[model samples]
Target: MSPDLKTSIVASLESAAAKAGLNLVSVTQGTGFNGQPTAVFELGLPRQESLGRSLNLELSDTFDFDKPDLLPEMTAHLAGEAKRLRNPRPDSYVTLGGLPLAFRKFQWPFHRSTSGADTYIVHGEIRLEDGREHGLHAKISASVTLTFAEIVPAMEQPYAETFIYNAVRKTVDMGQLEFLKSGNRQPVPVTTRYYSRWQKKFLFTETDDNERLRYLLSKVYWLSGVLGGSKPVWIADPRDSQYLNTGEADLLRMAGHEAGEGLMVLDGEFAAATPALMARAAEYQAMLEAALDFTKPKFNESMRSGQANM
Candidate 1:
């Protein structure tokens, strides 16, 4: 399910990358307890010159990744997500070589590219001075190359799109990060609501989680209990049994939980004469009618026992 893993990683990475002037090139997922994933990403960019600037980022073999390094930090995040999917971490699954820098670098007098020109094709062997070894095995490297013309074109000016804002939103969503001091970005609140007629306290908000399934199961269980439970019954006399006193009868019949013949009992909270609650009264009324019917026959049958009154 490389595609599946790719889709999942890309979905997460693109969202994170977009706000940072980058985008996921691709993600390849493999199988195993902790199979390594290979993901490629492109910055929202025109393939630029020498994969632009290469700065010294430390990833010590003994640096205790426990210490903070941006690449490790970011990769760690990606790996955590992999863990969520029950997959292996990047370190465990794949051999991540030196991180490469891909961007544009203006040559000396930095002349931009000439587009749609029938004039002439310029050529030069451009080499990117990226990797170097400082004292004590400290490595500095540049893993990219680019043509000046390819990097910056004269016709179309490159506009800087900082992924800072979107990145901030994603970071805040993660909640692991306090706001980064990189640029202007604010955390937005996520609103979640839960409502069910079967239960009270139907609202829950989280700055962290939107527990949709929990609410769904709770509502489901409540409904199952109700639909599968015995109904409460309260009987009262029904004076007019025609078409449910028209609108009033209709409302009460519904509220009282009537099923053609029997009025339904209701929860105690909504026992007022509200249109819905009237059904309880209707159920009571049906019960009264039954009792009255029984008594009327009983009165007649009892005449033999009390013939003088009859």
Candidate 2:
């Protein structure tokens, strides 16, 4: 990229970051693992430089600097990322069924699968974050099919994070992933099946209005009531709206209904679980238990027949 283009991109990103309460400390150009030119964006919270994160962008393949709309689109993407990073646990998420998991240690800039498979893979781990010390988690290798990879603009952190995270969550929801105290890295295939070319979007799970409402309540109950010391949690996260096949305004509307029902208190786009919601703790606990059970490996007739020998 030309120096002028780089400068313009950096300036736009910095402005967006500042508006979103993040400091864009620096933007450095480097070579990515795929041998492509990459831009590394270092960001920090205001007055807390020690707590910082790096977001990577692949420049050559992902953007066309000559396009008039490129800068604005990039700026909008950065702003959305900044909002997600402002959350108490940006890497943490709650499943629709109430299982809270924190995704971490992801090896980014997706690599060609070494297993000779026609896919790109990123390795990561997800730990159960239900405000308990059970230490249950899973190591995973998320693989993107070559066909599916075509639709992804870039394999870098900024572009692929939300969809990959949602794929993992969806895998768990489908009972295809097992969390254990220890285990080898299991596979989570991300294929074109998760995307709708017609809709031009990714769909993790099909949820109705009732399911959406329950998901919002469960998110507040766990993220705020259980883990966040009763602080309000952002309810209308764009990442979530994308994952749930809904819009931010719809999420806010659901939050408003939740407030009316005394299930939570809404402060703009943030919400905290109310006592009325907490009173149904047993119900939430049961949901988590059921979700956990669903994720466990079930034995087939043949496996069960051989269990006695084992």
In order, candidate lDDTs are 0.24, 0.79
Runs of candidate 1 with Cα error greater than 4 angstroms are 26-35, 38-310
Cα lDDT tens digits, model 2, 1-310, are 5788777767766676677667776777766545666566667667653245444343433344334534454555667766555556656789987898888877666889877999998888999998899989999999999899888766656568789999999899889899999989989999998999998999888789999999999998888888776767788787789879999999999999889999999988888889899888899899999999999987787767786545
Model 2 worst lDDT window (10 residues): 57-66
TM-score of each: 0.17, 0.83
Spell out the clash pairs found in candidate 2.
none
* lDDT at position 120, candidate 1: 19
List CA RMSD, all candidates.
Answer: 32.7, 4.0
Position 225, candidate 1: lDDT: 21
How many residue pairs collide in each prediction? Answer: 25, 0
